[model samples]
Target: MQQVRAVVAKAKNAPVSIETINVPDPGPGEAVVKVQACGVCHTDLHYREGGINDEFPFLLGHEAAGVVESVGEGVDTVAPGDFVILNWRAVCGRCRACERGESWYCFDTHNAARKMTLEDGTELTPALGIGAFAEKTLVHAGQCTKVDPQASPAAAGLLGCGVMAGIGAAINTGAVGRGKSVAVIGCGGVGNAAIAGSALAGASRVIAVDLDDRKLRLAEKMGATHTVNSRETDPVEEIRRLTGGFGADVVIDAVGRPETYQQAFYARDLAGTVVLVGVPTPDMKLPDIPLIDVFGRGGALKSSWYGDCLPSRDFPMLIDLYRQGRLDLDAFVSERIGLDDIEAAFDRMREGDVLRSVVVL
Candidate 1:
């Protein structure tokens, strides 16, 4: 048994407590990772709020960078000392989606069978199959994606979740390419990442829309050619005006609200693509939209799951890009704090004060 300090939400809506937890020895399919850094993502907050499920005493961190400390008997994909990024989705080769060669949508993913528990023996539910806020986390070997070790952990860990989702919304779901016009609504970590992805993909005009001018300015640094403060102006109208009276070729909704979704739907050129990467709450309903407009638009509507990322394929490449100074992953790391600062980080996130507050263990 390995006893380690970890951040855990003991009950619904309770502040996380830092405590010593017992992590069992790796089982047949597990590996233990010494977490180096983790990003405070909104999904972790959702889990703490009991929005994801009823699972309690959650080990609440997922977007992380770590080093392999040990492996189980049959683990071979990664070994001790390997530098890795932890991903929640671990593709199972025999799943129906994998059998069809669409491993990105693999229905059955792998997670560690071993359990990490509190000192009193209460089992802890890991956040998104990866309890990474701790000094060390246990995970399925496949959850560990190897990447270039030279990249900063603060920056690379963001790719494990929100950043990858945004980039994938454009490149994978929207199929954004060179000279295509693209607009990203919502300039948070995910939205800005989409804008950056659009720029990297060679989109000719990348327009960013958001309510906060602070976020808009940050989006500009991420490669948006134009920004519209949605609070001050109508985003759909501005997007159309910026694109020569025609809507953009692609629009991404990273806000996941009815208003933002509507904007994304109408801000695309006829036959253009709309990609939704933001997750909506369970009770949020789609606004009344005309079915005729949906049919008349003649465009694709796609939802990106983890940015449609194949971690093994995308992580290494993106890290290399970051190393080459092509992708500004570092721009998203607003501040780095110790593991004890997660709750404060959440507060900062709630107040829209930072893109990402990283926990550097």
Candidate 2:
């Protein structure tokens, strides 16, 4: 076992503390990663707030890139010194989804069998099974997807989660194609990434909707062709006006609220897709839209889990695109800080001041 510095949340709605934790040697199908960078995502904050679960003393931080330090006896996919993006979804081949050849929807995923413990020997729950806010972390070998080493860790790490979710929501779930029109609701990190993904997929018109003008501008920089300040105008109507007075071919709701979802439902052209990539809370209720509207919509209303991405395939491809300068992953990284700044980063995230604050380990 090796002692590593990590940020841990001891209780719900409480600040995280930086402390030393013991990471065990890699066991079967596991590997130890020397973390290079980790991004502060909303999910971490949710976990800290007990919104995710009552798993107290949660190790918070998931979106990450690192170098493989060691691998277990049976691990062969990645070796020591390989640059990798850590993924939360470690597909278990025996799962029903994997048996159906849809590993992306793997019902049973793998994590480290051994636990990383606090100084007092209390077992710690690594966030998303990746507790990457540390100098080192242990994970299932499948969770470490090799990527281009040339890519900056701060930028590439974003692809491990939010960026990938947005891109895959458009490219895979929404099936955005050449000359298609796409409108993305909520222009935060995920929504802007969707806009960029739509552009990369050859969508001719990408409309960005957000209440904040700042985010809307950033969305345009990320390849949105049109911007809608939802605070000033009705997004559904604006999207229609921008897409030839009809509606978008794909409308993605990156904001997981009933209001935004309703707008997304109405902002797509007939027979077009409405992809929900954003997460919703249990307290939220759906609108009483007539069942006739659902039938008349004539298209799929899908929810994308982690954008339906197969990490092995998508991670390297995205990193290659970033290298080619076609996909600007760097734009998503608003700032970089150390692991100790994670709590402050959470404050900034709540204030809607930055897209992503990465921790450079």
Candidate 3:
């Protein structure tokens, strides 16, 4: 085992600390990664607030890019020198979903069998099975997907989570197509990504809805054709007006709340798609909308889990796209910081100003 400096959340609502943690050598089907950079995700904050579970002493980084330092016996998908983007969904091929060829929905996934621990021998629950805010971390071999080493780690690491979810919400789940009209609510990192994805998919009109003007401006940089400040005006009305009095062909609710959900539902054209990529709290409930409206909409209402991503398939392709200048991933990296700055990053995130603060290890 090796002791490395890692960010550890010791208790709910307590400040995180940089502590020495014991990282084990790779065992069977496992690998050790030297983390180059990791993006701060809201999920990490959820874990800190005890929203994910009561698991304390949580290791809190998941969106990361790194180089494999070592691999266990019988591992051949990647080697020691491979550059990779770490993913939470490490598909287990024997699962029923995989048997049906839908590996993205694989009920069973793999994580390192061994656990990392505090200096005192207390076990740590790695966030999303991928605690990467450290010098090095251990994970299943399948969690490491090789990507172009030429890409920036700060940009590439984001594909490990939120950015991928937004892009996939538009391109995959929403099926955004050429000449289609699209509207995305909540222009955060994920919402802006949906706007980018919709534009990449050749959407005729891409409307971005947000309460913040700063984010709406950023959304424009991400390929929004029109911007609506929801606080200033009614989003549903503005969306309908933008799409020629018909709602957009695809409306994505990137902010997962009852009000935003209802706005997304009513803001889509009949037979249009509504993709909910935003995560909702457990206490939050879907507000009462007419059951008849649900049946009469004649469109798909879907929830996106990790953008329904197949990391192995999507990671390399997106990295290549970024390299080719087809995708502007660099826009997502608001600032790069040292690992010690994570607590400050959390404050920026809570204030809703920073798109992403990357911990550059």
Candidate 1 Cα outliers beyond 4 Å, as residue runs: none
Candidate 3 least-lDDT 10 residues? 300-309
What lDDT score belongs to each candidate, Candidate 1 first? 0.93, 0.93, 0.95
* Candidate 3 structure lDDT: 0.95
- Which residue segments of model 2 deviate by more than 4 Å? none
At residue 328, what lDDT does model 1 achieve? Answer: 90
For residue 328, model 1's alpha carbon misses the true position, in angstroms, by 1.3
lDDT of 3 by residue, 1-361 (tens): 8999999999999999999999999999999999999999999999998999998999989999999999998799999999999999999999999999999888999999999999999999999999999999999999999999999999999999999999999998999999999999999889988999999999999999999999999999999999999999999999999998989999999999999999999999999999999999999999789999999988999988888889999999999999999999999999999989999999999888788999998
Estimate the TM-score of every prediction: 0.99, 0.99, 0.99
lDDT value, residue 267 of candidate 1: 95
Which candidate has the highest lDDT of all? 3
**Residue lDDT tens for model 2, 322-342:** 999999999998999997798
- All-Cα superposition RMSD per candidate: 0.8, 0.8, 0.7
Worst 10 residues of 2 by lDDT: 282-291
> How well is each residue in 110-149 modelled by candidate 1, as lDDT tens digits?
9999899999999999999999999898999999999888
